[model samples]
Target chain A: MPTGSVQHFLHGSISSNDTLQALLHLLRGLCEDAARGSIPFLDQEISYTIQLATGNSSMSLRARRSLMYEGYPWLLTYYGHTDSADSSRLVAVRTCVQAGTSDELPKFLSCIGFKKDFELVSKGHVFKKGDMRVIISKFYNPVKDPTHPDGYQPLANEYLVEMSAVSPKFCEVLAREMHTFAEQLKPLVYFEKFIPESL
Target chain B: MVVVMLISWESPEGMSPGHANEKLQKKIEILGGKILGKWDVDCEVYSSLNGIVGLSDTQTTQPANLGGATAPQQAIYVLHNSNYSLSTFAILEDNTVLIADSSFDQFMPHMKVFYKKGQRSDAKGNRYELNEFIIKTGVATFGGSQQKILLLEITYLLSDYVHESIGIIRELAKLLLDNSFPGIETPITVREDKKFSPSDLLLQYKALFSHVKKPSTVK
Candidate 1:
């Protein structure tokens, strides 16, 4: 319920590599601190990336990061997403997360009351580009289990959360799309089964 | 075979039909072919050529075909010191070939780059190839989808100048069969054809690169 007690620090810029490396270094320390605490972070899903220009069409200011969502494995990926009109920028990011129970990632994140932690700083624009947006989010408090009724509630994971939004106003758009992304992010615990290791 | 030497014709106009090899390239040129690259089998003679040469579109193309669609072309040189013999068809009957624009083309042909024991250049040990031969033909028809079969021929080539640029022989066979409509995914029935499998070629390629032992299931 307290405000300004825990400030979610973010380093944003039109420059991708610079912003990403700084955020990563900060996240590493933040996760380390959060893990050391009594916070009940069953698993922490951290993902970030940098994107490059798709082709010679330099209309879209080249260097930037696209929609970064939490997923399994702290691995880097360079792929393309396209449609009939234009091709998405080439992106390479690493999604690193600690191992935990399968199908439990979504519930774990929800139980920690992460969605509610965005009440304060989660209202501003994280970053943006042509049809691209980045939103900042965080959850420090844990929401107790309703079924347990009488157990001492655990502290949910407390770490910096910064995500990309497609529009110029990233924060507001993410707040609107939060429900959809929450459903998507919840199953990240089982995302491992989708791609085979031997491919 | 994860890797294979791929050879596309430079141009039939320039290539004479004298040697045993230039025949396919000549055919490709007359047939209006698009030469991707070439896998030289007689690799033992690569020492005479430059370590690696990048040819612009104009350089690779014939005088008439110059200034056409061609990415930067680069040739990789290979050399081997260890003892290994040419792969005979009598040994096996199954293999898978692959080539990749990025990664995960292990089943496709690849050029394995290495630092030869004493060679000064990096390209000396690199083996280039396109293993997956998806021979395809036919166009989409009225009632059916594209009436084409994707045949995969897993082949590999060793670049030890002494050897025939890894797998140039197999590619030559595939190139020669261009007119016959050899499907890229053509199934090589081991029982009927009595030919070695893709896995056998894979091990042979690996053995050329290192001391890799062949698996039991591979024939």
Candidate 2:
């Protein structure tokens, strides 16, 4: 694959079913000229935060393994902060590999010697609008698998909505356009950038 | 596991460009560095906006709040090298570098392409197979209408130890370029260390970029 474009993302949340429907309607109208497709699958992602044993120092590594209904069985992703803590913006370099089996997860982690700090599971529906991708995902606590009859509880009632594109240069322009599209869905699904503590 | 040292060069002593190219090639032949092939290494730099955290290739601990969450001291960059081997250089704020086989295009949905440069060269020697000196001469192009810099990169693939090979590479460089190599006294040597990161490489490239972008004195 040609791996050289910088991706930009704007994230928000959709809390109500009515807002989702309205947002979808507005997306269809805006993406009419762009190639559109539905990712008719419940994509699951398990993100493993890896940390070096350095006390409470806030720099560590992260790995994410994802599986889609129609996609490959195991897609492993690893990334981390390449710069220092004082940079104005956060930039990370990430690489993805296809693991033949699920058993390779532990082996991969051990080889890198990064301790698993935390894990989060998310499942979502994806929509591709031209080069832009819109994902609405529901985060869940992985420790409580609903199938295992444990305390399975949704992380939150709101669905995380993300609008992303592959080009860094055009991100601001695209973000502006996305903001306009998101404004139409105001009060329904407000899309903005998510700021995690690590960032 | 190959160690590389990149040295930039320019024509010496009022020598014409054509004559300088011929002289470089002749010197390589004399040193038994056979012509291996040619390479066109292209790279594009992507950075995040001020105070915005973009995609990360690895997990990170939350940075301590330095006073207030204001502008940072260093800027992070994802450098995409589009040579035969595709690679991404993630330069962190603290000079931490993370290199990966995959590109940053997939992760950063919003990135800015600050600069683009293509280094086209005639590569010589099979450092991997023959364990000899690998040399390359190329022209690096930064954005502007007329900005191209000559680059000469020499690699010693025989040993993983950069310190051991530096003396030999320096001797060879002195003979071939006749001290025309820029930064010959302190060539950019990339050695393998736990802390050695892509940021080091980016710093070198940034120097080249600034040097090339400077107003030309030749005109």
* Each prediction's DockQ against the real complex: 0.02, 0.04
Model 1 Cα lDDT, one tens digit per residue, B1-219: 123221222113443323323444354446554444422211111111112211121122111111225321222122221112222111111111211111211101111221011111101111123343321111111112222111122233333221332245455545554543232322122222333433233333322221112111112
Estimated TM-score for each candidate: 0.22, 0.45
Worst 10 residues of 1 chain B by lDDT: B114-123
User: What are the per-residue Cα lDDT tens digits for candidate 1 across A75-186?
Assistant: 1122221111211212212221111222222222222111212211111123332232334333222333455432223233233334332222123344334333333433
Model 2 achieves a DockQ score of 0.04
What lDDT, from 0 to 1, does candidate 2 have? 0.49
Predicted structure with the largest DockQ when compared to the true one: 2
- Deviating ranges (above 4 Å) for candidate 1: A1-199, B1-21, B27-219
